[model samples]
Each structure stands twice: as structure tokens, then as C-alpha cells.
Target: MAEREYTAVVYSTTSGRVIYDLDLADDPEWSARINDVGGGRITVPLQGGAGTTRVREWCVPLRYSLGVLLGDHVCQAGPIVPYAPATDKRLLTVGFKGFWELLNRRVLHNKAWNPASAKITDPSADIAITDSLPNIARAIVDHGTTWQNRPGSFLPLDLPAVLPGTGTNVRNYPGYETASVGQRLQEITQVDSGPDVLFQPYLTTSGGFRYIRHRMLIGNPLLVQLGGALKFDYRSSLVALSIAGDGSNQANTAFVKGSGNEAGTLFGYATDTTLIDAGWPALDMVDASHTSASVQSTLDGWARADVALYGTQPEQWQAVVRADAAPPVGSYSPGHYADYSVKNHHWLPNGLYNYRILGVSRSSGTPRGCVDHQLQAVRTG
Candidate 1:
């Protein structure tokens, strides 16, 4: 069976309590509706740390957890808007980001006196493992009790050995951009940690925070054969395909230049390539606020990864497929959804099809709740 009802649960993240629960309605096109859902991405918005908006004449503050419920599962979207008023003339255009989106809104952990560390030291020498993304990710996420679901790292960071007590004082600021925690984390996984550690921050269907490291964009595939896939009477289906290439997913030559506060050589370069291309070149510079030799090595590793992704040959891509199915309305199912534990229809790498509900939105219309939410997936292999 499919679900036809929805409830937007509002609760204080500050206090962690249910304040109100608003259900899906088909009254008019001016209230609320849910649609455009993805596995880890959705569109739901809030404001300030607190405030109020008019819902059916009643004022609802912009604080607390704004969770969406459909069928049998509930997922936390984010905090409510803090300061929007009920009488604002313009339509309050608020599109909250997935948990990962919100998480990526802050800078990574780095300070003037001390920056995040990517250096590898003997297990006995350095206990903090400071700059490690896995280590840093935990510290960054373990802050609030409001929406911090499960905090852990799944990165198989089988980092190789490094000399102990080499640059005991050398450090990297990793730069500070009022950017997102996700963005800051990007700086490391893409440039600092190099190929040794690459990760993608994601939110589980259960609302837990996790890092998809080794999987890259390729998770276990989902089979959609006649009797192999979950049974769903889908109403509509869409498959979008595209291909691209840098003509260089792999290179025999790679280089990285860096900059920072420490005073060393004015010019330096790093190469981790082993191929004999006569001169297959892949180059990049890192202003990620690094100047140490360790940083140079890290940058070199990044160059190698880039070559791997854009050097060797044309990158073969896949198409994205989306569907819409809801709880059985009678004899037809419009979309398909299930628990994270079950084989839900969400996105996957290598064509494992599944779906996750990001959140929903509300808009004014002839019938307030008349929006079609779609379930999107990738073309299964």
C-alpha cells in the first residue's frame, strides 16, 4: 500500500519537544504541500533562529524542528525560520537545504594559533589525529542536540605511515570562509588529504549524518528486473541521460603549488605520478592556506586523484531516473517509497535504484495542497 497523507511535524530543536503537527490538506493552493524529494536533497526552508509565520491565520514561529511525515516514516528537515512574519507581502521563498546542505554552511575547524592537521604521525606521537576529516567531522557534528542524529565517520582512511615528530609546529588554516561545514570539509577531502581520503557528506533516510568515503559516487547497485525489484504501481517515470569528458581522467604527470603564512621556498612543486607519458600533464594550485612540505605532499596526492578522475580517458556517465508513487490510492500507485532498511527507490551509484524523501513545501493554489511530489532514481545497471 502507498501513503496519501502527510504531516509536517514542528518541534523545538532547542528543547526537543513536539510543538505542533500539521497534516497535508487539499483545501486550496495557498497553504502547504510536499514535492521535489531526493535521497539526501530536498527543498524546505526556515528563517532566523526564531520567528513566526501565518499558517491559516495562526502565527507559527520560525524555530524548532520542521519534520515531514508521509505514510509511516518521519524525517527532520531543519529549523523553522526564526523571523518571518505572517503579514509579509512577498511570498516567503524559503528552501531549506538537506541536512548535509545545512551542515556545509559553516567553515571547517581551523584557528590562527592552530589549523586542522593532515600530517601523519606515529600512533604513539600524535593522538589527536587533528586534521583527519573523520576526526574533524565528528567534532564539527557533535555540537548541537537539535538535529544532530548519528555522528560518525565511515571513511576507510587506511592512511599510510608518516614520520613522527617531523613538523610538530607546522599547520594549515585550511582557510576560513564563512562557507559551509560541508564546503570546508570539501577543502580537505579534495585537496588536503589527497587521494588517501575522499569523502562525501550525506544524510541517511533515518536522518543520521554520515560520510560516504570509499563508495565515491558508486554504491551497491539496485536491480529493477520484473520480479527482482519492489512492486509498485508507478504513475509516471523519467530518465535523463548525459555524457561528458575532460579527455583526461588519468595523466602520467601531475603538479600542485601551494601558499601559506610560513616562510620557506618561494616556489615548490609536487608530483605523485608514475606513468611515462613523456609529459601527460594535470596541474592545480592550492591556496587552502598551506605552506609546509607535508602540505605539498598532500597537494601532490590531490593532483593524482584529479588525473584519475579526469586524466586516463573520457568519463563514462549514467542517466538519472525519477518516478512518483504514493500509498495505494485505489488500484494505482503513483510513486514508490520505503524505509532506509528496505529497498526504497532512491539514488545510487552504478545504478542501484532507491528513493528518499528530503522534505516538502507549501504554496497557495486553487487547492492549497495540490502538488505532485516525485521520486527520482538512476538508471539501474
Candidate 2:
């Protein structure tokens, strides 16, 4: 009914080629969507952040590389299962921050002068970080690049990674002695400090990756109150809102038991009270691989994560809004604006509430360069 005017730019960092002028009216077939929609319902999987329980995945297509080329050299391993398209323009092309994430995922060195296939070695492959989950997750994603380019050909993949330690921490290629540049970054964010920590990698307004931990974008919230010119569609578009669990409640406390990895027989344990009410309780937890955190800390970590994730019921609010303004709200690029919280004042059946966009969707398609704030109430008591 309304005339749509917007542009989408797909760039390849490796090739430094930009394909622009992608207006919705130009090609209706080349389109994308925010979150995901099917059967008139829009749903988003768990995000990566504190108090979360799953890891987000980044799988290459059957016959395509990721947005950007990061590994030493890529090749078609062989005929892969399923089916891979001959070409996908989206592959091997991405913005700056995404490329940085890929480069840091793995360690690379050039033996000769700019060799296509460099001498790749990873010192952080076999051992898990044990320091922080984010660091450990980064290590895994770094190595995952190598896996994407393994000798054969595999694409359209969805690799899942579990918690405590990445599933692919101690990785080894089928016939090779070393590991690739990726590790399992698949897991939910543990919510001990605050709510709205993402379980998957989100995109900041600056086109950089947003990890759901700490207070990065919650300083000042943008209010979309009455008459703010906010645009949304219930039936036609794929926007979803719902509530789930909360894991930060006091009743969410539980017992954790562990033992030392040394010669003698050493054991330790703690309850919900000792871990929840008592912020920093002393518990003996020692191991050869990890010692930076105590046994009680680890247990407390899990308890907090559980409570924040599944303890209290969480309210999820998301929408695909539009702005007829000059630069669409979804037209995100670096240095355009800072990552800030967005509150949508709504008229609900019960009453009106201001829900913040706690976690966001990094990948979104725009009909008029518009995007949706995958909003979840930060304080849902």
C-alpha cells in the first residue's frame, strides 16, 4: 500500500567489494527477516549472555564460506552431505567488526611472504580458558574458522556448543595434528549480575558485535512513548513478544559439590543460601586445569545463571518497527550512534509498560531499511 524506499549494502571484507542499491522494490526475492518467522508467529532462540543456557552458532553453507575469509587458505573438501549452492553472494563478505572477530578467533602466522596457506598453530586449543566463559568462547570461535575451510566441503551447518567448557575445546582435525581457528561459542548467557544478557552475539549500533555481559548498552534508555512515530504490524510482519524464566531469585539456590584434582582426596560443597545470599563464600575447589575461580564460585556461577534464566518468569517483547525518516532506524553502520536501550510504551490488555530491548538481533532484513529491537524487559518482577 505504501511506497517503500530503502537500500541494503552487502560488502565483502576480504575482497573489499561493495554491492549496494539493494532496494526492496528492486528484488523481492533477495530478502531477509529479523529473528525468524513461520506459521504467522515470530520466535527467537535463546541469546548468549549471563544467566543463559545455550550457545549461538555460525555455520557455513554446504558450498560457501562465511561472510568473510579468515583462515589461511580455503578449499572444497569434497562433495558434502545435504546440498550446497554453487554460489552465495552473502558469503565471504561482512563489515569490519565481524572480520575482526574472525581474525581473533584463531592464531595465524605467515611462514613465507603472504602465503595463501600459512603455518597455523593454536596454543589455546586443547585447554579451556577457565578464566571467563567469554574468553573461552572467543577461543573456540577463533578456531572454528579452520573448520569452515576443512579440505572437503560442508555448508549450511548449525554447530552447537555446550557450557562449563566448549564442546570442541580439545579439537583435532581428522588427519591433521593441530586444531582449527574455531571453538564452540554455542551456549546461553549466564545471568548472575543482571537480566537481558544475550546468549548469542548481537550487533551494536556501530556494526560491532555485542556480547551480553556487564553494562554496555543499558546506561540511558531511549523512550518510545506516545506519539513517537513508532511503526509496527501485528499480522503482516514477524514481531513477537512473550515471557520465560528468571534464575536470580533466592529460592533458586542449589547445592554444588566438587573435588580436588591433586594427589590427596579433597572434596567441597555449598548450598543455595551459601552461594546466593552470601555473595563471596569460601569453598575449596582446585584442579590442575582451572583455579582462578573457587569451587563455590563455580557453583554460585551456575546457580545464578540458572536462577536468572529459569528462576523468575521473563517477559519478552520484540517488534519490527518502521520510520519514514531519512535514515531508517535499521540502517545501522559504525559511528552512526551508540548502542543504547530502547523502551516501547505500549497499550497492553492489562496496562502499559516500558520494555527495554535487552538483547538484539544481529542479522535482520529490512523492507525499507527498518529493523526490530528484540526487546525483553530488564526488570520483570
Candidate 3:
């Protein structure tokens, strides 16, 4: 097989303009996550020629972004950040975090301006939004991107389109809260009746380089079966497998405390009686924060979701597969379903198990040419 070459380019964050092209990146590796910010790394020699110096100068942390490409397709992209130089004093490495970091940097409320004082200040009341889960998420992002003293080139991102009519989720951000946009999104989407939030990147057909699209998807985005031709079969594509089971942090009961003081405080509990009836002691967990939860059902929603996730012995499966294997890299992303099977075990029998893909990681220039897939069992009990 021929050597794989990866190229990179830097773009201005505020104006989305091309800043520089990184033609000499070494050891480029990237990772993507479903629920959190993903990142990548590229290395350059410190003593290289004029171009190397240019890469160092143009890579302004937080102001610029790096987009890695395989031919014309962008494999990974993110805002550039500083990293400690490589130990040998020969190479310099810079890190780039995913576009999701933009959400992390902003808050729930748009900046407010006072006419008489001629100044901008935080809103007087908390941001309260009640809508379908997807719509509510989009609202948070829309207002979160707006600020009072933005640069001239700072353009507010357009609200993303979301699937219609999926029940409702209530979120409240008190005036004092200033909660992170990313954290707020995660909190709303990870609960019962919530959809999965995905920040996907795409290249523009015209002149726009790489752009990110915020999406809310319900359930698994793609489903793979045990006998499907495109799968991570243990007999073929699976290079190595590591299975881990842990119940140390497991809980069968959850007491969710909502906003209020003293006797007026809202409290809700959800318990998985099946676990207790099966001889496992009733382990309890308390989540004391929904400061904006006005109704008891809001706290109950969180309680049920928490109990479902933490109520069982969670198992994590990490599998490494050849990059060119069926359902290759880029073909499958986080939130897809994978049907895995292991043949003949002494204690664990030969059977098929379903898991939801949580993350994907790959490193170019490695001898293995492998993609690491992280998965967790889809709890449906």
C-alpha cells in the first residue's frame, strides 16, 4: 500500500477566512466524540525552513483553526491551541479542539444593552425556554452565540434546523448561572425524551472551506446487525478487543432535587426495582442541581434518565480495527450501533451483543494503520 499523506490548512475563526496552509504537518492524529469536544494534533520541526516558521507564526491559539484533509475531504478540523513543545527540542506540536469548543466558550443568554448607561450587561432574569428537545437545543445555541462587544467581523451563526415535534424538555438558566453552552446542551439532551446532539463537519461545494452543522438525532443514527456485510466482525475486521465491566459507581435509585428552598424544594425519585428484586442492594444516587426545574416532572425526567443509565453494570468495549476494514473510518461515526460477537468463552458464552458507538480515534503514520472504536452497551432494561 502507498503511504498516506495528510494535509492541513488554517482558517480565521472570526471571519472564516483562510489564513495559511500547513503542508509540512507530521504525525497527524485526530479523535471525535459524540457528547463532548474532540481534538487533533500535528507536529512540525522547530528548525525547519521559512514555511515552518510561517506555520508557527500563523497558528494563533483560539483565533485560528486547523483543517486536516485527505485529498479534498476534511478528516478533522478544530480551533488551534498551544501545546508544550516535543521533549527532544526538535519538533513543535500544536493542538486543535473541535468546533464544539465554541459552544463551551459562550453562555446561555445573549448580551443585553442598557441605553441610558450606554453599556452592556447581563440580562435581568434567567433564560427560560420550553420547547421540543431539538428546538430548545437550537434556541440555546442561537442566543448563546450572541455577545455585546463582538468584533466587527464576528457574525452570529444562523439557527440550525432540527427535526420537528418530539415532545418537550424544559430548561432554565438563572441570571446568576452563566452556564456553559456546551454543558447546558449536554444536560438537556442526555435526559429522558431527549435526542443525541452531534456537531458534524462538512465541506462547502462552492468556496467555503469546512463548516460545522449542529444536529439533534433520536436513538441510534445507524443500526448494524450481527450478520451484516458491513460490520466489525470478530472473525475478520476486529484486530483486538478489550472488554471492561464495572459496577463500582452503579446505582439503582436516583433522588433528583430541583430548584427551591426548605420545604418548597422539588424532589423526585426513580428506582429500578428489578435490580433490587434480583438480590442486588438498592444503591442510591442523588443529583442535587436542577436549579431551574420548576415542576416535579422535570426532576422526575432527570431521575428516570439517570436510573436507566446508572442502574446497571455498564460494560465498555474497545476494539481496534484496520483502517481499510469494512465500515471503514469516516463511514461510521459516534452514535451508530454495532453488533459484536465473541465466539466460545468459558464463562461468557458465544452470543451477539449490541452497543452504541461513543467515540472514534485514528492516527496516521502509525504501523498498525488502525482505527480505535469505543462503544458502550445500549441499556434498554
Candidate 4:
């Protein structure tokens, strides 16, 4: 049997926080070398090793003004910008212009040497944009066909307005609240002029508001498929209740958890029940007398309805149940069920909050059932 030669490549991120490792098989045609390999470390030549490969190299020049800080002994470190070799299969994080430059240089310029490849199952862009109601309708008509044909794919859209009185409004249409704007734009743009457009809203939820945004991705279940619940006592603001309903309180002063970007806060846990017996807090931060079962049921119902109408399966959706003794407003913070205006403040003062649901066919990848866009007129405080 021919000996199989392998090379390990380990490189750290620019921030020095993440380290990536790659194992490559030696191919004589590539003429690569594994200079050293031991103790979980390997080094390879800049060229030659494995099969034919594409590599991106970057270099940064550094400058410095002499400075030192110390009381007993002085030590110095220079400012250095690091470089890491880019892998072929991984997505490259770069600026828009940089991406365009790379695409033009590697893909477009070297078409003869490297054939421009396309995705076999090219999912539509995660989000879409549009401006007019008729255009949104037309987008639904068109993209809807494609989405229905592909079950796992998603399409979203952004538009200036979809309110009831908007010139190109489609809120009156049923199921519009659930249909994504991308489908709407694809349906309407082909037929008429629409307004300015952008990407669709990606939805996420957490405790407290019952709809706090998280870093998780929406539309695709693979991103955040894990389901669990957690509980915390705002009164102490110190300890975390474990998923096993065990009180594993940490002495760390910074311990708050949820979906938002706040630091030292933990959010959802892995268990369906919490160790703390307190009731779920109200939206206004006032203590609610509701039973945990009741609150859990309400949240479960919302998730179930969402899945029944939009999700492909019940397991694809998950929710976090929080028990707070105080209402959000009572805590002088944003309240749950606050009007859409307080929720999506990025839009103009009068912009409405719209809801849409959509279903795409698993076989043909075309869109099937589409809820017309629902526009809740933006409320002025």
C-alpha cells in the first residue's frame, strides 16, 4: 500500500483569538513539503504541498513611537500587524471593495486557468429589497415560484413602506404579514416601479420582551437549532441558575443573561423549567402573578403558530421562558408589547411595523402560500 503523507497547517487569526488548523495530504505533483511536525504543530513551505491550491497573502507595515510603562521593571512590545494564509473553502472576510477586487483578480481575470464555478443549489440571497407595493406583489409572484421549489432556502426583502395607505400598499392582502419582502419585491418589481428597498428583518427572541434579538440567524434552523430555557433572579443580580434546576451560584458580580449584547449576562438555559419559583416578569417589569406553565404555554403557542404558518417543522422553532418579578416599564426600561415604533426605531417616525409569512415548496423550490404584508401604522409617542 502506498504511504499516505499528511501535512497539518495551523494559523491564528489576526486578533490572536482564534486558531485554525488544516490537514493536507501530500501530492507529488504539488511539490509541497512538511518542514516540521510534532506536538500538534506543523509547518509547510509557502508553495508546493498537497494538491494545487489558491492562497491569499497580506502584509502590513508597522510604525512606532517609543514608549514604556513599568514600576519595578520595564518591558516593551512593538505594534505588529499579523498575516494569515487564506483557505480556499472558507469565506473570506473583507471589505466590499476588497471582495470585488479579489473576485475580479482571482475569478474573473484568471477564467482561463480557473473556471468560474457556480453553486449547484444556489440559495437566493438571504435577504432582498424593494420599494413599491405592486413591485412587492410581483416579487412574490416570481421569487415565490423559486422559493417553493426549494424548502431549505430563504428570501427576504426591504422596502420603503408597506403600510395600508402607502401608494403601493399590500397590507390588505391576507398572509402578507408573514410573507418576506424579498418575495414581495420579486413579485412586484417585474411588473411596475417600486420604491427604495433594503434587506428583510431577521427575527430573534429572548426573555423579558419575549422578543429580544440575539446573535443567531433567522430563516435557517441550522444556525440556532439548540432548544433550552434558563432562569435568573434580578434581585440578587449575582448568581446563575443552572439548567438542571440546581443553584450553581457564581460569586462573579457581572452575571446577567439574555439575547441582547449586554455583557456578563447569561440568557437561555438548557432545561424547560427553572429552579427559581418566581413568576415570569411582566413587560412593564412589574411582577406577574401568572403561573410558569401559563407563560410557557403562551410562548410555546406563539412559536407553534409561527411554525404552523411559516416553519417547516415544530422542532425548528425554539423559545426562552423568563421569570421576572418586575415589569419592563416598571423597571424604567423598554416594556414588552411596546408599540412597533419602540421596537424598530431605525425607521422613520411614521414607518409602520409589517408582518409577513411565506411558505416555499420543498420539491420545486418555488414559493407556495404567501401572507400579504401586514402593516401596523407606526405610532407617534
- Model 2 — which ten-residue stretch has the worst lDDT? 72-81
Model 4 earns a TM-score of 0.17
TM-score order, best first, reads: 3, 1, 2, 4
**What lDDT tens digits, residue by residue, belong to model 3 across residues 24-120?**
5364788777766888888765666875577667768987887766555565666787766777666678889877787787655544422244422
Cα deviation at 177, candidate 1, in Å, is 9.9
Instruction: Output the TM-score of candidate 1.
Output: 0.42
Best candidate (score: TM-score):
3
For 1-381, candidate 2 gives per-residue lDDT tens digits of: 234332233222222233222222131211111111100101122223631221112112212112111021110111111222124231122112222233223332211212234333333223334334443434344344334444322122222333353332221222122322321222212213311111121212223421111111110012112223333333333233344334333233333333345553232322334343546343332222212224444445545454444333344555554433323333321111222223352533433344444322323353443344555444433
> Looking at model 1, how many pairs of residues clash?
47
Model 2 misses residue 121 by how many Å?
A: 14
Candidate 4 C-alpha lDDT tens digits along 253-327: 111122224363222212111212333221111111111112232233323322222211111111111212221
RMSD to truth, every model:
12.4, 14.7, 4.2, 25.3
Quote the positional error of residue 378 for candidate 2 in Å.
Answer: 6.3
Q: lDDT of each prediction vs. the true structure?
A: 0.32, 0.28, 0.66, 0.21
Which residues of candidate 1, in runs, are more than 4 Å off? 1-7, 15-18, 23-62, 68-70, 73-76, 80-92, 101-133, 143-183, 191-255, 261-294, 312-381
Report how far off residue 202 is in candidate 3 (Å): 2.3
Error of 1 at 344 (Å): 26
**lDDT, candidate 2, residue 13?**
24
lDDT of 1 by residue, 301-352 (tens): 5565554433444433322223233322211122223222212234323323
What candidate 4 gets wrong by more than 4 Å, as runs, is: 1-149, 155-193, 200-204, 207-381
